[model samples]
Target: MSQEITAAQRQHPTRVASKPSSYRPEVQGLRALAVLMVVTYHIWFGRVSGGVDIFLLISAFLLTLSFIRKVEAGRPLALGRYWMHLFKRLLPAVVVVLLAVLAATALFVPRSRWSDILAQTWSSLLYFQNWVLAANSVDYYATDQSVASPLQHFWSLSVQGQVFILWPLLFALAAVIARATRVRFRRIVLLVFGVVFVLSLTFSIHETYTNQAHAYFDTRTRLWEFAFGTLLALAIPYLKLPRPLRIAAGWVGLAAMLSGGFILDVQGQFPGYVALWPLVAAALVIVAGQTGSPIGADRVLTWKPLIRLGDMSYALYLWHWPILVIYLIWRGREEVGLVGGSAIIALSLVLAYLTTKFVERPLRSMAWVDAKKRRSGVVIAVCVALVAVPVAGWQQGLQVQKERAEAEAVQNNPGARVLLDGYEDQSSPESPTLPLLSSLGSEWGTLDGDCSSYDDGPTDPVLAERCVGTDSQDYEKTLLVLGDSHSQQWLGAIQPMAESNEYRVFALMLGACPFGEPNSERRPECNDFNEAALRYAHELKPDAVVAVGTAAHPTEAQDNVVAGLPEAAVDLAGFGIPVVAIRDNPRFGVNMIQCAEANGDRGDDCAFPLSDKLSDSSEMAAIFDSLQGLALVDMTDLICPDGWCSPVVGNVFVYLDDNHLTKSFTASMSGEFDRRFHDAVHW
Candidate 1:
């Protein structure tokens, strides 16, 4: 929104106006340098852009200095005036970018991805993009750059806006307190700065240890960096430095700031001591500027090219990230190597410069820049509303379309449909035997797990107590399939086989349950769900108990279920009752649905091989070997052969997530699974 400004002689009751021409070209050069570091780091280095830290210091110095000078001059501080200036400076170009991005996304990205883009666009417009991205917890160091969101660049702006909203109030309050109590303004301000600094520092460390992702985005954790700048601001004017000392500080600061760009890497735990280096460097440069030293800001930062970049820095920062992200996504790699990444950076810079020249500068110099007669707020509101309304509608429409498409595709491709919904009913005793005629529409009715409500037992369409027809059978041979979704996913295949083989399969699975002891409050759910599963297995007196999951170990039980199971199920020598483990299929981390849509394949042709899906790591191999008193079935060969696994094999979709095979794929592999089970367990 734009703020109303007038040529009237009015000023705020608590502020004084500084000279209007206090524009510092050197600061612009600093901004240019900061943006360059951020863009380069994000695209090629996978590290914090020391540039952002530098920018934060600049912001703190400029804004704090402005506020303090006005307050000290016996003039009123108009919060409205400050907001107006900020709004005019920030809004027009941001709104333009949002509109352009919204248009580009609609035209280029798949319908399935539109929802994410829309949400991000809205957040970007609101300057809340950082929080939105933080909530998603995207890993910056991850090699998969294709999944990077377009609006991820807005996090810095979000942090800045958040700090801006608070810094002024703190300054005003500290000033008022000093005046009221006859305390020196500097002392009062410094005390407030110290308190904020301490609180922010303490919280940042705690958050970094507890949740680094949260620490990165949370305003509380970041407030200290800005406060550090604020502290430097209060001390600057009081210092009257000698010429040589000022020159040395300037050059040293410049070297420290520039050198920091090369020294810092992504591995550094950020916002800790590492950030202070750049912040201090920026502050030193600013302080040196006032003295006009030969080795200071004027000699280096005011160079033509640096000034040019600095003039466009704000626009560049906004534009560069999205360009790089979209380019990386287009390339469809987890990590773009440095060469390609550098090319992306070059392109982003070109666009940034063009955007700054055409969009930001013109708007700032317009005759209406400070006009109060016309309602600029109304114009901004309209502009924002136009961008927001379409994006929201597009997002909602895309969601509906995706759901419809997913439903249709699932219906048409019975395998994916079955896996999506069949787990619920198939695991129950009454409905354990899925009708052979049932297709993808055969709904599972909802399953429960200790960690998830999936196994809480059917309350809806309330599954009959004996769905598996277990009461009619002589419950002599019992098999338990317990673990996470990886284990539960097998119900469609295993249940059918168990029913035909005259064996009952008892399940004690939990979603995301690693079979470990209680960790969170959710532990109760795990305990209760496992207890129910174990009770049923024990009562059935099965000949064999199968613990099936991609990642379940014998000692990792929630309450030592392995020791509690009837001794008949456990034989020191391969256990009397053999456990059967089904190796999970490959999982695609990228949203295959969106990829399919983008490729215009109608969601059928886009799939990768199992071997190509994930790295061959010890963690995966270990998950396959953790079952005790059981025979593990290595199905990696069933789905993958010659070191390749296709998403669609024999007209079957192999997986829904990173692991669970689609029911269609499961059905296709049923014959293979049956053979593996028979060979391993002698069933």
Candidate 2:
């Protein structure tokens, strides 16, 4: 990639196209409004600005009209000419902004985030950012206080680019279809526009209600905002509002848009029926045209200061987000002091002005005229190379980093591979291994309960006899272990214990089980896992049953699981096999080995204080209290002693990932089992 860039740079000369003097200030003013909305919303409230929504409408209107005009002049909509125009207009500013951000990200973004920036940069340059982000399934409201990427805003720009790519084809198709049908060009365009608008609107509303996150990134769902503007262009010749009415409509529209953008949160229905407010407002404002004077509409929107800001709006928008994000990164917090934030905003404005004046204006004003064909193409190629080079380098860097991480894990802790390849007994008894002292301890003993069942072996008489002798000899002890990946993790720890103890461990487990009663928690998966486990456990009629689960960051609903379980498990308790509740261990933020590699330190040197790692999940405590008469084990003391938790103890590495302990770490905790069992059970 780097070599390709070098070759391209050597072969091409960069050039820029001059914008015609007839270019309107109102457009810049609109740009200013869009930038202002995006910046303010991001810094203060973290939301999508109606400003961008306005821009989308304006872009649709302006570009469609331009294309239609060219087509009417009897010229084919030349793809190369259209693309060259777009490249010259958008790329220079975007390239400059992206380079600045790329540098800033390297200096400030954590290695964890570098890969994301690298991916986004490539996606942004290619105008596929929305799809890339959607594929990653990034939670727009995730609470991680990482610095925001400057290029994060490019998703909208990419959406626009994607629209343009197809819009021309659609426009040409509509023309051809209209010409063949003997219908007017304008009517056909309006008809197509209306159809697209309805589809987009319907999709937006449905997705917003069902899955707003998905709706936000969906291009098809967002098409109506642009189609609305296209429809306006078609209607422009037919509908003319009186000046007073047009002005009134403009102000009312602006107000509605502002209200919706400011008042709406990410949680609310977005880009749906609610989005119509801003889209309609933008349509009205444009329809009012420059002639309509809706009282103070001109004064409010066309003010010199606003116009100046609008002129630099493109540059300002380009610069603001990265600055704010870098500031957040440096400060190690999302909150910027009011004064500091204001200063940053002011700096962004000044930078925007300088960029607009010195960079944008100069470059855009230089007419390549006759040089437009080859020289302009060369410049576009160079810009593409620039974007592609860094992006390729970044992707390669991630691959290297992953390799390094794995190598580090193995080098520093030889058994890391063994830990990750979790063990399960399919044919025979499995060996025990300790989990990390951190969260997800290795305590999964079978609880003999009423619901325990027999496991019949295959047709193999020998294996069937072994199963009957060992597992079904006495259907007196039934046990269940249900939970997240954490619960599945305890299989190695308890399989041996269950066999020796003569109990059938009924594994009613699923990944991410929220150990609770049916219907009490809203998590459907958790409810289902418990429902099946509980039903099966109820049927076994063993002496007593035990249930174990992950207590990692236990929520209120999880607490309900513990509270609700005692009554449900009363049948097993009645048989004298007391219900045993196991308390989970603390969790480290990142995998112990991975964190060590990134920190350039060893696990021994980097272990956090026990208090920091150990979380007292209220849910687990409630469960313990709920089953007071039953045996309960609080494993915190075993995992952390004397206010200290070691990532590596007794020469064993701890966590296999951010949360779950390594098998070796869990194996070491087997001693705790003996101590707890001697006191709790009479085997």
Report the number of the highest-TM-score candidate: 2
- Over the stretch 229-335, how does candidate 2's per-residue lDDT look in tens digits? 89887776556888787778767766776776667663356678787777777677666656534363544777689898987777887788888888887666766
TM for every model, in the order presented, reads 0.68, 0.69
Q: What is the lDDT of candidate 2?
A: 0.61
Q: What is the lDDT of residue 63 in candidate 2?
A: 79
- Model 2 off-target regions past 4 Å? 1-24, 135-147, 292-296, 357-375, 394-398, 401-405, 408-411, 414-517, 523-548, 552-583, 587-643, 646-683
Tens-digit lDDT track of model 1 for 600-666: 3323355444445443534544643554554656666555544554444323345443345445455
Q: Each candidate's lDDT (Cα)?
A: 0.59, 0.61
lDDT accuracy of residue 65 in candidate 1: 73
| lDDT, candidate 1, at 663 | 50
Backbone clashes (count) for model 1: 34
